[model samples]
Target: MRTLHRREAAAALLALPALALGRPAAAQNSRPVRVVVPAAPGGAIDVIGRIYATRLSEKTGSPWVTENRSGANNTVGAAEVARSAPDGKTLLINADIQLMAKRVMRAVPYDPITDFTPVARLATAPLVLVGNPAGTPNGDLGALVAAMKAAPDKFAFANSALGSMGHLSTESFKRRAGLDTLVVSYRGTAPALTDVLAGQTALMVAPLGSALPHLRADRLRAFAVFSPNRSAQAPEIPTTAEAGMPDLQFTLWYGLWGPKGMPAEVVNALNAAVREVGAEPAIRARLTEQGADPVDEDAAGFARFIGTEAERNGRVAQEAGIEPE
Candidate 1:
């Protein structure tokens, strides 16, 4: 009887963790999955997050909702997700801002690497240098560089978020080009684009997808694309190298992450759902049209990629002399 009692106690101890999780398994199926986009509605991250949520919900028979928690260079929403329970319900879908927030900010509320588990890399798109044709003299990279060098603090660069790809990539470009262009931060992409269109800001480095519509409508003109090759959606635009800023190459990438300590099985399921969505013809077509290249990395691969990206972006930030806020 004594031995049986000890065995039963060990079994209970083993089951305690699962019991304490309060339906971690149910999160994958029964409950709604909330994907948190740490930006305003019109940004590239928000656009992709909505697409993924809609497709994943339809594919998996589990409702997925996108919640915008924009502010503080993405920290406000990130911290909220970080502090959430580690069940699969709450997730984060963001861009390179995830890796850059800590490197560019003075006091980050959550650890970009340790506070979350990377679930999968969804897609990557080149950052395009766009200018309002009405404001820019030549509407080309060489002219823009020359203009910045000629007039210090005369031109303003607009960024949707403080630590976003637009911010980091523009800073790096400035450092490399030996230019002193003033950076202007806006609440989100919509406002930033509005200012750019209205000629309030001279230039903006943004995700190709976010700038595509304006470029097509002639509201904004593409100067250079920050990729080794021109994007399929806008092949007429020259690469940064061809446009005379060879070293200013940067790509905007998006991925999914859940709060730290989420179960491996749940992570795997989410990754599989993303892969399935990527395989759909319509989804792939839409992503391609938006200048994104679909990626199908699993959870472990995504984690490793995030680790490397954080290290690389930290080095870039240090090199650019961008002091944390």
Candidate 2:
């Protein structure tokens, strides 16, 4: 009995606040609430999730910790959350990729909308079109488009994932520019950027935060930013509107969510916590450093926005002939 008790205690220590180890918010316990980031650690969403979790722990007097569950373009983590108890103990912080699972892949496990409750929109980052300096002519978008149109068979774009903001936005841009080129989907951004830097691919629409350092280091060239105005980090770059691609409009946003059927009070409390964290100057500064604009929005508002975005993206994918894989 003594040896069995020791083994059980060791197992409990190892599980120290990960997965769905904690009880529901209604039935509180000493275990910490797990804030799941559906992406690997040290990535954009993981960084933001950690920041929010740290602040939420202090703000709500509840121990909150971040847990990573990355795979299948967020399907693995999202499905796990959908199956978890609709308690406040397990939460999700994911990017706009949350809505694109159905449109991009054929074997998604859950409905992105109905399986989860949208809590609040945390931040948004502008997407920029970037190309290798040596790969394109004279670092100009017009020149690149002309050359791509002239020889449509040679050039292709690289996207980090199938349903990522980078992928869909680039496809939309290709359609708008009237180019019939291939878009190679890599497993992640680092590998895709590697190919772009090596001229294996011609261009990619990446989040400003991910591309800014490379652009600053002279490793890549900026063709356009998919926004109304220039990014303050790279003010020298022109907007998509300025580049004469005004039809391409998209922003990479991060949001908070939980399993469906969570109590309204729990959802509202989490939403309020996000807003309070968003309003902090320190938090805003951190997000700004990451090239994101923090946003303040309610749950219902975010839900409506998700519906609109999903519909638009689905239409765009269909028009671009992006079939599920």
Candidate 3:
């Protein structure tokens, strides 16, 4: 009888963890998944994160919550996610900043490439190349290039953040154009656009949504969009390829990630959840309204893209001589 009692006690111990959490561990699907958005509460990133969170909850019949963990240029929240368990319960929804954390800051605690499993790519925000009216009145890409080449010393590019995709895209353009123009970094898009508006800066590669009002008001001249196709919001602007800079294209994108070595099933389940939710017509329309285009790549495909992007970013950083702050 004592032996039987001991066996029963062992069985109870085995059941404790599952019961204590109020759910089984099959999909890590037993409880609410916490999605950490490693940026501020406003802006397209936060809005998109919230939309995904709500949609995932409805589509999966599981609860998902998004928490803002904005700091250290998004590395603080990312490091926290990297240290989390690979249970799929705690996840991260961060921007491309996650890819270049170490390249931009010294205190990054995790390798962006290996420390997390890629779940899905959320969306890509297209960019526009604009010049202050005072600097480039004609808004012609060909003429602007010639002028910049003639007086490269007079041109300065303003990007919102140091390691942002816009900044990297600008650097790539500089190399392709073979001009050594100065790039000035600012805290946010508004201030950078303000400077460009006032002609304190000569040019800026800005998000189409953020720069649309200024462009509509004719405060800034649209030179070319750094995208493969023209944006629906600003169809008048030519793409980089149309402007004769075919090799220069980059975008600010967002992705979901789980800790390293999560069970393959868990990753697939979450990936499916994201895909299902993203496919909803309503969700797609909402994303479009936010100046972002939906992405539809699976986990492995997303990982490969990240590797390619990291390579491109590395080249840009090397060329620009970016040192970690």
Candidate 4:
């Protein structure tokens, strides 16, 4: 009887390991996924992040939350996400400025390429060249380029930050056009746009979504759009390429990324969730309303896209003599 009892006890102990392994890990799928936005609450980046969060939650059967950590031109939030666990739970709804331009500007806490894995490309939008409707001398791209070329140092352009995408795009324009113009850097886009509209600044380059309402209301004049093609939201406006400047093609994009080395299953699941959410009719409408084109590329595609962007922007920065701030 004793020998039989010992054998049964040993068998029970061996089965215990299998039973524990069969059960779900503690809170692995239950914890909420965090989506970090590197911009302020009322900005386009925040809006995009929120939309993704909602759709991801619905598709994944898990709670996804958007956390705004706006500072350092979006580096703060981006760094936070880069340092997070290599799990799909923490994600960054990163803008081009944070993911691409910030690295060129200064030495950040994390590596943009090696530290994070790209999950999906969310949206792409044109950058609009806008000017004060009242005092601006030029009405169109040709006229503006001519005016700047005629008196190089006389014309002034305002930008949100020194090394920001808008600033770089404007610099590219200047270099390609062989024109010299003064650049004024501001703390943020809101203040810069306010100054431009108030006629305090001659011109500014802003994303189409931010410039659309003003353009439609006639508060500002649209000079040229920096995009491969003209925007559907404002089809009447000509693209930079159409304006006789093919070299000025640049688009502001946003995407999702997490820390590198994330589980393959988790990455696939997140990619599917983003694709589903981005394709939803309501989400599409909302993005279209904001003058953004929704994109839903998988991890490899997004990674390749980001790599290309980084190389392109790096060249622009080097050619334009853009020094790190």
Best by the TM-score measure? 1
Reference-based lDDT, each prediction: 0.80, 0.79, 0.78, 0.75
lDDT of 1 at 174: 88
Return the clash pairs for model 3, or none.
Answer: none
What TM-score goes with each of the models?
0.89, 0.86, 0.79, 0.84
Candidate 1 per-residue C-alpha lDDT over 28-137 given as tens digits, one digit per residue, 9 for 90 to 100: 43557788998888888888788888887765555778899988888888898999876677899988888877666789888888888888899998889898887676
lDDT of 3 by residue, 192-288 (tens): 7788989899999887766777888988899988888888978888999998888788887889998887665566666766776677799989887
- In angstroms, the error of model 1 at 216 is 1.2
Candidate 4 wrong stretches, greater than 4 Å: 1-29, 101-103, 149-155, 186-188
Model 4 lDDT tens row, 1-325: 0122444433322312222344323323566778898776756677777877876566545567889886766778888988777656688986777545454557778777788888888888788998887756646788888877887665688886666689889899889888788888765566677788888888898878878889999999998889888788999888888888887877878888887776555666567667767788999998887788789788888888888888888888888888777
Q: At residue 106, what lDDT does model 2 achieve? A: 95
Q: Residues 1-325, candidate 2: write the lDDT tens digits.
A: 0122444433322222222233234223445778888776666777777888887676554578788887888778888888876656778888988988988889988999998989889999998888888777675678889989998777788887788888888888888888898888765566677788899987888878778778889999888899888888788999888888887888889999988876565667667768878999999988887788788998889999999989988888888787878
TM-score of 4: 0.84
Model 1 C-alpha lDDT versus the unseen true structure: 0.80
| lDDT measured at residue 104 in model 1 versus the true structure, 0 to 100 | 65
The predicted structure with the larger lDDT, 2 or 3, is 2
For model 2, the local distance difference test gives 0.79
Which of the numbered candidates is closest to the native, going by highest lDDT? 1
Poorest stretch of ten by lDDT in candidate 1: 11-20
The list of candidate 1 runs beyond 4 A from truth reads 1-29
